[model samples]
Target chain A: MIDVLYFAWVRERIGLPRERIETGAATVAELVEELRGREERYQAAFADLTSLRVALDQELASFDAPLAGVREVAFFPPMTGG
Target chain B: MRIAVQAEPFDLGAEVSAFTAGVRGAGAVVSFTGLVRDEGGSLSGMEIEHYPGMTGKAISGIAAEAVARWNLVDALVIHRYGKLAPGEAIMMVATAALHRGDAFAAAEYLMDYLKSRAPFWKKELSAGGEAWVAAKDSDEDALKRW
Candidate 1:
């Protein structure tokens, strides 16, 4: 099981901050695809991957990166905090 | 190492004292406090949102990375969530080390990574109404210096 966290507009779009999901996703992209197939909100949240950034186990990771042994995954836009 | 995400303002001196008082072998401490600023006089108020558990993990991860990279002794990261007025402290960082070099560098590195890494969003509430603050290109550039 992996924990998925959404932030900012992603959370606003999905109407949730976090969820626990069991998946066969081997990569971030595959996980995103799994999420996108769940519902319209998920589809809208995962739409336009260019604006989204993914982190695996709290480290900045790309969508193509493998997710093996990763316990947490987060999706958010380019950070704006200082 | 304490990580707080709250709407309440934090006392800088108190935080520094608490951090130093808890950790030994910390000879230097460096801090950076960011305040709400009007970006081009467009934003009046700011509403910050963050994922609760994820935020702690992210901040701790970045702080750990800084500790490893710079040989820091301890670190603290406090960020405010929810609505904040102009000039309010948005976030603060405190890094402790055996030397000033480590403390200062680690503090800055942690700040840079925190800005680009943490999953917090800010929307500017202005006279025109509320709008999401687009990620600034300058913030990305600042992270590159690390």
Candidate 2:
């Protein structure tokens, strides 16, 4: 199972901070597509890909990156830390 | 190197003094603090959210890179999350080196990376409304220089 995490507005929109799910998706993009199909909230939270960033196993990664052997994935907007 | 991600406010004076005292053969120590700005006098507070599992790891990665690249004697990073009042410190960075140049450069590098690369976000609560602070294009551009 991959633990999917969300933060900031994404978490607010998704209505939960995180969840664990089993999936057969091969890439992050495919995983996102699976999430987007789950409900309208997921669709809305992911409506704009450009406004979102993804991390695989807690590290920034591209959408096309493989999800094999990854245990965690996070989605959030661009960070405003300092 | 030291990295702290917590909800507790840090004492900048004490942190700097302790960091400086702990460094070996360091001639220069530089520190930078970032405060919660009440822009337009509307911001009452801010909520900083960060990934629990990634924050320390990401910061350690940045600090490690800064230490390696600048040959720094020591480095420190402290970031606070949860509700914060205006004028309160949001974060701080300190670096130690044999000379002022490396210390200063490393401090700047830590700030630059911490701004965009770290897994933290800020939401400002103002009199008018609450909004997430947008990531400036300039912030992303700033990373290219390093």
Candidate 3:
């Protein structure tokens, strides 16, 4: 089980803040594809990957990266680090 | 190296003191606190939203990068979320170093990066209704100078 979290516009679009996702996906991209198929809200929220950023277990990571043993995945916008 | 994101208000003096209490040989401690500003009734308040785990890591990464780029002994940042009233504290950044120059420069740099790169979004609450504030291009330009 992987904890997936969303923030800001992503949450607004998905109508959810966080969820525990059980998946057989191998990578973040695959996980995203799974989400995109869940509902229209997810599809709209993730429609443009170019506008989103992914973090695997609180570390910045690319979508193509493997999710082996990953515990958390968070989707957000390009971080404006403070 | 302290990072916090909270909805409750923070005491500036206490936070700064806590950050510098154990540090020795620090000649200068520079701090910046962001507050809610009244935009002539254009805004009634501000709603700060952030990614939970990602928010901390983002701030930490920026702090780490700033420390690596500048000669600073330590950095501290605290950003608040949820609803905030006018004149309330929004965020703070503190840098301590052996000299004034590094402390000041790094503090400013960290703030600039924070406003533009962090995964936090703020909405301006006004009589006109809440509107998500877009990322300012000026902030992006400011980061380019570094």
Give the top-scoring candidate (TM-score).
2
- What global local distance difference test value does model 1 have? 0.86
DockQ of each: 0.59, 0.94, 0.45
Best by lDDT: 2
- Tens digits of per-residue lDDT, candidate 1, A1-82, equal 9999888889889998788999999999999999999999999988899889988877779999999999999898887766
* lDDT at B135, model 3: 66
Total backbone clashes of candidate 1, pairs 3 or more residues apart or in separate chains: 0
lDDT of 2 by residue, B7-41 (tens): 99999999999999999899999999999998868
Docking quality tier of model 1:
medium
Question: Per-residue CA lDDT of candidate 2, range A3-55, in tens?
Answer: 99999999999999999999999999999999999999999999998999999
Which digits, one per residue and each the tens of the lDDT, describe model 3 over residues B62-91? 999988877678889899999998889999
Identify the leading candidate in terms of DockQ.
Answer: 2
Better of 2 and 3 by TM-score: 2
Report how far off residue A24 is in candidate 1 (Å).
6.5
lDDT of 2 at B32: 99
| C-alpha TM-scores of all predictions | 0.78, 0.98, 0.84
Docking class of 2: high
Model 1 residue B50 CA deviation in Å: 1.3
Worst 10 residues of 2 chain B by lDDT: B36-45
Mind giving the per-residue lDDT tens digits that candidate 3 earns over A1-82? 9999987788889998999988999999999999999999999999999888788888878999999999989897654433
